[model samples]
Target: MSQTVDDPEGRLVSMIMEANKYARFAAVCDKDGNILWNSHRNNVDNILTLDETKQSLRRAAETWKVRDTLAEKIGRGQYAIVGYEKIKRITVPLQNGHMLFVSIEGEKPEYIKDIMKIVDYVERNH
Candidate 1:
């Protein structure tokens, strides 16, 4: 009951991979909240958890709908939105039109900062 879109390119992939290593848990989803890619997932659990799925979707929708969400920020050429979650600190608004959901075990502002760097790097290249 879902669909997937194409993936992000350039430094985004490398940046996500880097974040996974440091964060220990991370996920990337499309604007519609479909799973496009994930790291440390043994059996694609994020798609299975209904709560998480909804939360992911909310993040996406807010980004696209709200005024200050990551999607809006990226759309307006502002800073990338870094979401601080209980089990994760994530970088959002992947690429120009996609969404990224990262879940790390511990709090690492540095990791989130790194993710922002990736966004900045990608935007510059694009």
Candidate 2:
């Protein structure tokens, strides 16, 4: 008999989803915002098209550039947290220039804590 296990990527997404009730979307993408894995197809939220994903990635890249510049002048940046009118985008830089992007509905203080936990989990596990 053979046992089959969920892949690491799937498991990571599951962990993220389970960890945050308001998590609208979670994804792992390159610096260019090319999504390697996403939770949207799992019925997370509004399905993101390829173009939308690309555009989001581009915007994230720009945001990261600004963050890096600011960090250089002041201190190291822990993470990037961008708040939109409806949702909040939390990004954590991973190894190899990849990023873990997680979006949660609404702007809440808990989002920061959730992101920190998620980032720590990813850093330790992935």
Candidate number achieving the greatest lDDT relative to the actual structure: 2
- Which pairs clash inside model 1? none
What are the per-residue Cα lDDT tens digits for candidate 1 across 1-126? Answer: 112323344235546665445454445566666655655534333423657665765665466546445434455533344445545545466544566655555465566667767667766766
lDDT, candidate 2, 1-126, per-residue tens: 112226545455566766677887777776777777666524545745768867997788667767777776797566777788888888877655667788778876476776677667766776
Model 2 quality (TM-score): 0.74
- TM-score each candidate: 0.56, 0.74
The lowest-lDDT stretch of 10 consecutive residues in candidate 1 is 1-10
Q: What is the lDDT of candidate 2?
A: 0.69
Residue 70 lDDT (model 1): 47
